[model samples]
Structures are given as C-alpha cells and as structure tokens.
Target: MLKRKLLTYALISGLSFSMGSSFVHADVTKLRLAVETTPGDPLNIMLASFRDTLQSSAEEEVELEFFEGGALGSESDLIQLLRAEQVQVLPIGSDIVELDSNFAIFDMPFMFADKQTARDALDGELGELLADSLREKSGLEVLAFGELGFRIISNSRRPINTPEDLSGLKLRTPGSATRILAFEMLGAAPTPMSLGEVYIALRQGVLDGQENPLSVLEEFSLYEVQDYVSLTNHVYTPITLTMSANSYAELSPDMQEHVISAAQEGAYQTRQLSDTSDAELVEAFTSAGVAVNQPDLASFQTASVPIREAIAERLDAVFWEQAQNILEPR
Candidate 1:
C-alpha cells in the first residue's frame, strides 16, 4: 500500500511540473506586434529585421506575430490594446503619443531641422529623456525611436509653394492638435482623418490634399490620386517602438535585454530603409506622372513661426523652452 501511494504521488508531482514548464515556455515564446503600415512598406521592412534578429538570438523559442495595415485597427485602438497588455509591441507614429500629452513635444512644427538632426535628437540624451518621460507618464516602454522621414504635402490642387497657395484648400491631417493648428495657421482647412481613409477620400475628391512622408505617399498610391507633390517638410515625424509596462515587467531580465536590443537594432535598420525608400519614392512618383516640386522651404518655415508660438503658449513656456533646449546645438 505504501509503495502504491508513493508511485501515485510521484506521478502527480511530475504532471504538475510538466504543466508549469509548458506555461513558462508558452509565455516566453509568443509576441504580438502591431504596425499601421502595410507589409511591404519600409516600416514593416524594419520590423521584419527585428523579428528575425530576436528569433535568432533568443535562448528560448520566440515567434513574432505582426498585425499590419490597420488589420489590427487604428493607432488609438492599438494603444488601448497595449495598455491592456493584449498587444506586446507597437511601432507607431509620434502623433499617437499626443494621447499621452507628454509626447506632444514631438508635434512642434519644424522642431527637427532635418532627418539627421531628428535622428540625433531622438537617439541622444534628449531621446532618453523623452523615453523616460513617456514610460513614467504613460506606462509604456519606449524601446527605440526611428524616423518616418519629414512630412510633405501632396495635393490634387495646385502646388503649395507658399502659404497663400494653401489658402482655402481642404487638407487632410492626423488627429493631433498640433497638426490641425499647423495647417490652420497656414490657412488651409485641416480635416482630421484616419490614414486608411485618406486614399479613398482623395480619390473621391473629399479632400483637396494630404501630408505624409514620401514612403507613405507611395505606399497608399496617393500619387495616383494627387497630381502635385510639394516638399513642404513641415513636420519631422518619429516612429516609436513601444511596449506595455505590464508586458515588459513580465519578461525575464535576460528577455528584457534581448527585446530592447532587438528593437534598437531594428530602429536603426528601419531608419536606413526609410531613407532609401524616400529617395525611391520620389522616383516612383515621378514615373507615375506626379508633378514633384521642391518649393522654397523658407516660406513654409516663416508661416509656421506663429503656429509654433501659439503651441508654446498653450503648452506653457517652460515645457516649450525645455523642448527647444533639447533641439538646440549642444
């Protein structure tokens, strides 16, 4: 009787151990990431690099699942999922950060001088400061910051060489206060819409124009709908790789290090892909018979000064000043 009892006890213990091991393995093996861009877009190309690198380097089996091109819903929806720990990671536009208010700094028009300047700002001390601020304020971990390239204007109407040209033109913009104010300051009627709707809206003449990076413009085939592409470079946009604090806390220390490292590497690669795609997109637009023009950027800059001042006023002078300090030569 004693022998039989021992055997049964051992069997139960063994089964419990096996189930625990399986649960641990399952936790370590799965990751779900969301991105708003299509699979072939530069953003996805960069994410693929991260996915590959993480799979190769992790000690445990790792699988990355991507929800792309609004298949997972809009950025706002994804953020909610991240907060709920349903989604593990999101590569989202800076505009999405406005939901947290602290991320509003990135929306400051002409805040970044160029791509290189923006890269330096985000990858340097300022980037760390911003990332830390975001983690503290929003309960999300910013693994890495990347470039979406500078945003330019694409319109079905005449080329916008000066602020006057934008007058009365209905322009589609992201649902950020800064974006709306920027276009409003420039005298254009800014319509806030989801990116997925922009292409259709433009096609149906619901919007006179929209703004985005060259890669985005090309990805959505906006070139086919819009006749004029103006290199306004009005806003320097950054793409952030964000993870839920709850999800991140659940990772083992080793896994956490691996995840952050992989994201940083992916961000660097994505920036390169974005740069290359920007150049290629210009050619693609030209080939597609879109009239591309490099208008004097000075006019755009001059027009934005008042808009910046207004934003600074609303955000309080100190916050705006600190942001400027971060961008200034150091």
Candidate 2:
C-alpha cells in the first residue's frame, strides 16, 4: 500500500447486517466465506475444500458458509462485509487493488514468468510482504494467496494473433489502471467493467471480448458468447483469502491455528487446480467450439515492458526490484 489516499476499514463499522443472513449461524463458531466466482470455478472449489479441511480440524464445533455467484455482491461488497465483521473470510481477485493500489503489482502485466515461479513468489516472502501491507492498511488477515492463474483474452470479433490484432477491439478489463494502461499500450480499446456485467456485455455485442483465466471462461459460461481464445497470458494474478482481523483475534488460539492451516490447504488446492487445468482448459475451449490460438506471446510481452516498468516504478522502485529478485527463471 502506497500510504497515500488510503481508505480505512473503520469506515464500515457503523453498518448493520441482517441477522437472517444465510451465511451466519448462532450455535457454533461459523466462518462465512464470500466469493464472486461462480460455483464451479477453481477458487470456489478451493474454498469448498477449505471449508471441509477447517471444520474437520477445528477443536470446537465450526461451520463454513459460502456465498458464491456474486450472491453477497461484488468484491468491494465483500471487503465492506469483512470490515463490518459480517464475514470471516473472503477469496478476492485482482480487483483488490481498488482498496490498495500497490496490490496492482500483482496485476502488473507479466509479473511472473510462469505459474511455478509466481506460486513461489506468493508462497514465499513476497506473499508475506503483501500480507503485512494488507493487515497494516486494512485490518485484514491474509490467510493465503489464492491463484487466478494466467489471464488469456477471448473475443467474438476477430482472432488475436498479434498486438496489432487487438487494435480497435472493445476489450473488457478489470478496473485496474495498470491493466488498462497495458492494454492501451498494446493497442486495444480497453473498457473497464465489473465481472457481473461482462457476460451480458459480450453477449449483446457491447463488448468485443474479455480476459480471464480459462477456468473463469468455462465456469462463467463465457464460451457460449466468445468465439476465440488467445493464449495471450497478459497477466498472472494471485488472489487473497483474507479474514477480518477483529474476528480472527477473537478466536481461541487453537481454532486460529486450525483456520490458518486450512487456508494453506486451500492454497495448495488452488495451485494444484491450475497445474492440472492450464492445458486441459484450452482443450475444453476447443471442445466447446471456441477457436483457441497461441498468439506470439513475445509480442505482447514486449509491448508490456514500458508500461509495466512505469507502473512498477510509480508504485515502489525498491519493492519492484525486490520482487524481481524473488522471481525464479522461467
């Protein structure tokens, strides 16, 4: 977190949550986990596994309730819930940067050379650094870094074979300034949109396409609307499964350890899903009638240099250099 224009968690304290909310339980120490990903998405799958793992290991009676498919609202809504102590945990995607700009470093185009190196960065000190920043800035407990994997572009218009191919395409991007800037440098007309609005926007021709991991495409039914899948791998995003520190601090030490261990289990499941699906997802797209192409990744990687460097420098030159050091060669 840059420490400039910071939004404090205290802002959400005055709000009241409905007692009848499905995610809350009275008899047991219940953990409510919120996610925007559709039910079958790998992140959700990991969350479900986490639920089982935590409940089984917990010393006392515990329950984990999940709100998926944006049922509890957007990622921003979940953050507010965390602040209000209405939810115990949240598996948030890259949009987390909206709360802390330095989180944008995770979305910096081509931040990790490959999935393993990225996992190493996150599972190691780099992950702890971001966790410390999150706790310091927002009063959230970073359970573990969840994976979003490599982002690929999909379109209904033309096949994207090169950076030039993206020109004039109405590409839908997350609300990250760094991402928008990277796409612009690559020549695409990037439109910042929420995930909930993306499918309809693509289906109705309002959006030429969108970018996400392959699992998102299948889980969200993007394949039905988008005709092409380009392995652009423009960004590798690691999401966070975070808890409200206030709620966490109230737990018994034993329960707290169980929760922490379960989160690690969830992280493992998340990474394992990506390792197995990276290639299978492409085959899935092809089977679903989406034309898949391996574009000249070098072209997109090259286009990202100036924009990524500028964004990284503006964020933190020292931290960025440190991130580079932690990176394992692809």
Candidate 3:
C-alpha cells in the first residue's frame, strides 16, 4: 500500500512537470510584422534587418513573420488590428494617423523643406515627441520613423510644372484630410482611395493620376500606366514603425529592449537606402519610358501655404509651430 501511494504521487509530479514545460515552450514570443510596401522596396530591406537581428539575439525562439504588399490589409486596417492585438507590428505611412485629427499635423503640406530636413526633424526631438504623443493618445508604441522619400506628381494628362498645371486634374490621395485639402488647395481634385485599389483605378482610368514616393511608383509599376513623373517633392512623407501597446507590455523587459533597438536600426538602414536609391529609382523610371521632370518647386511650395493654415486651425497652432521649429534651421 505504501509503495502504491508513493508511485501515484510520483506519477502526478511527473505529469505536472511535463505540463508546465509544455506551457512554457508554447508561450515563447512570436511576432507578426506587416508592411504595406512591396518585397523589393527599401522598407522591406529595413524590416529584414529587424527580423535577422531579433532571430540572432533572442534567447528563446522569436519567430518573426511578415505580411507584405497589403496582404494583411490597408494601413488603417492594420492599425485597427494592432489596437485589437490581432497583429504585432506595422510600418505604415504617416497618412494612417489621419484617422485621428491630431495626426494631421504630420501631413501639413510642405511640412519639411527637403529630405535632409525631414531626416533631421524625425531623428531629433520632434520625432521622439510625436512618437510619445501617439503612444499616449493612440495606444501604440512608435518604434522608429522610416522615410518614403518626398511625394511626386504623376499623371497621364500633362507635366505638372507648377501648381497651375495640376488644376482640374483628378489626383488620387490617401484618405487623409490634410492630404485631400493639400491637393485641393493646389487646384487638383483629390480622390481618396485604398492603396490596394490604386493600381486598378489608375489602369482603368477610374482615377486621373496619383502622388507617391518614387520607390512606390516603381514598386507598383505605376510608371507603366502613367506618362509624366513630376519631381514635386512637395511633401516629405515618413512611414512609422509601430507596435501594439498591449503586445509591448506583455514582452519581457529584456525582449522589449531588444525589439526597440532592432526597430531603430531598421529605421536607420531604411532611411539610408532611401537616400542613396532615389537617383537609381529616377533612372529606372526614366528607362521604363516614364517622363521625369524636376519642376520649379518654389511655385508648388507657395501654393501649399494655405493648406498649412487650414490644417493648423484643425490640428492646433502649437503643434504646427513646434513642427516648424524642428524643421527650421537652428
């Protein structure tokens, strides 16, 4: 009887140990990162760095999966997923923030003077402030800001040499209030559409033309459907790498630090690639039979001034002033 009782106790202990071990292994952290950019885009190159770094440095098996090319859905869809903890991370366009009016500050027309100005503002105090504000207000942690280059105008109608040339032309823009207003203020009809639908719409003539970074223009092969590529360089658009606050809080402290560091490195590498690859992208677009034009940017800048005022009224003057201070030379 004593031997049988001891045997039963041992069996129970072994079962409990086995169950605990299984639970621990099953709980190993796995992350699913989503990017709207295509596989060959610079953003993907940056994300690859993060995946590689996390895999190498993580103590446990940290499985990093990617959903690219809008497979996970539009930026807005992914943002909602992050809020619901349905996905882990998203490197999305700045326009995604238009869902909240406060985010419109980033989209203020001609906000950053040039790519260099954009980079400086993003990597400096302004970037940190914006990231913190998003975290506090939107419930997401901003890991780092990645560059998508300055937006350019492309249409089959004609070359957009000045704001006057864009008059009466229908331009496709993301569903951001600031962007719509910016295009309208510039005298173009702004049509808000999902990124996934853009290609078909452009091909079918459902839309007249679109504005995007050269990298995106090349990625979606927009150069094929469009004729003229104006280097408007009007808006310096930045993509944000964001993670869910809930998922972030669930991570171990060490893991959290590792992830944040990796994300920062990814953003830096992406920005570097964008800086170096612009010339190559322009050349590629030209070679593909797309007419490239570097217009008189001063006119476009002058036309967008009204857009800034309109946005400031809705987003607050303080936010606009702070952004300007960051962009202006110290």
Tell me, by TM-score, which candidate is best. 2
Candidate 2, lDDT over the whole model? 0.79
lDDT of 2 by residue, 1-330 (tens): 333113323323322334333332444677777777776686687677788899888735687677877676667767777777777788878777776666878666777778887787888888877877778778888888878799999999878988999998999988888778878887889999878788899999999998999888877788899999999887888868888777888776877898889999998888888888888988888988999998987877787778777788656566666666666333
Ranking of all predicted structures according to lDDT, beginning with the best and ending with the worst: 2, 1, 3
Best lDDT goes to which candidate? Answer: 2
| lDDT tens per residue, model 3, 237-313 | 77777787777877878888888888888888778878787899889888888889989888877877788888878
Q: What's the distance in Å from true for residue 119, model 3?
A: 1.4
In order, candidate lDDTs are 0.76, 0.79, 0.76
Deviation of model 1 at 267, angstroms: 0.8
**Per-prediction TM-score:** 0.87, 0.88, 0.86
Find the number of clashing residue pairs for candidate 2. 0
Name model 2 segments beyond 4 Å from true: 1-28, 328-330
Count clashing pairs, candidate 3. 0
| Poorest 10 consecutive residues by lDDT, candidate 2 | 2-11
lDDT of 1: 0.76
lDDT of 1 by residue, 23-131 (tens): 2255565777777678766567566667877887884557677767766556766666566566678877855556455566666677777788889888887788777
Better of 1 and 3 by lDDT: 1
How many clashing pairs per prediction, in order?
0, 0, 0
